[model samples]
Structure formats: structure tokens, C-alpha cells
Target: MTPYLNLVGRDGIVVLIGAIDMVPRFHSGNLLMRRRSLSASMIGGIVETQELLDFCAHHGILPECELIAMADINEGFGRMERNDAKYRFVIDMATLERK
Candidate 1:
């Protein structure tokens, strides 16, 4: 985040990940006061979730991802272990073969 701070200009938006519960302290006391704000939010409950998905579908929005075969699971894991950003890696388990 230090690199990001250096690049942030006036009124830049900084979004944090939901699982990152702790706040990062900046060495400069006025950093937070420099017209910048941070946001991290948890997903809403079932109805809101359904609504969000519905909205996305209505707008033809979908996640950018690459599908890998179940047989290549180990290869995928190996790539992830190497910090490859080639895939989003999320999958729909319902669509998987039992084998």
C-alpha cells in the first residue's frame, strides 16, 4: 500500500479488501486528512445478494475468468503457488463432474 499511497493524487479512492480487518497506519499524520477515504464492506444478506446478481445479469455482466478442467487441478494449484495472476480460479462446484 505504500507504493499506492505515493501514486494517489488528490481525492483518490482507496478500496480495501473485506478480509483485511486491520487498518494500515501511515507515517504521515495528515495522510488520512488529505481528502482521501478508505472503504471495505462485507456483502449484504441473501436478498441483496440475489438482487446484485440479478442486476449484473440484466446488464450482461460476468466475472472475467478462465475455466480449467478438473483433471488439471494440480497444475492450477501449482500456478497459484507461484503467484500467477492468470486466473480468477473461482468455480461453480455444481457444474463439476463427480470424478
Candidate 2:
């Protein structure tokens, strides 16, 4: 986040999203001197979420994720342990049907 602050222009804001538990530490002077700000936002409720989904669909925006079969969860864990998994692992529930 410290390095990211440098990338934003003056008065630009950095918005942190999702469930981040740890408090971020950075030099406050970077924000103060540049009139920049940091903010956190929730995804919002069902209706707003649907609107966001619609906007993303209209813009052809998509998330990057790796679909893994339920049977291969152990391998997935191994990949995580070895830091080999580059994308978020989304368990494909339909994969369980074969078993």
C-alpha cells in the first residue's frame, strides 16, 4: 500500500475493498502532503449488488479465478502451501456430481 500511494496523483483516493482484517501501516505524510485519501467500502446489499453485477456485465468486466474440482482440493491446498496458486480457487460444486 505504501508503494501504491506513490502511484496515485494528488487528490486521488485509494479505496480498499473486501474483508481485510489487518490494519495497514504507511507513512501518513504521503497522504497528507498530497491531499490524498484512503477509504473502505462494502459491496452493499442485494439490490445494489445486482446493480453492480449488471454494470460489470455491461462493461464485460470479470474476475480472475481458478476453478478447481472438489476431488482436487488436496492438490489445491498443496498449491497454496507451495505458493503456486496465482488466482483465487473457486470450488466447482458440480464436480462433486461425478463422485
Which candidate comes out best when scored by lDDT?
A: 2
Off by over 4 Å in 1: 1-39, 91-99
Instruction: Return the lDDT, model 1, position 91.
Output: 48
- Best model per TM-score: 2
User: Which residue pairs collide in model 1, if any?
Assistant: none
Q: Please, what are the lDDT tens digits per residue for candidate 1 over residues 1-99?
A: 566665555565667756666777765533565676567677688999999999999999998886776667778788876766464686456567875
RMSD of each: 7.2, 8.0
**How much RMSD separates candidate 2 from the native structure?**
8.0
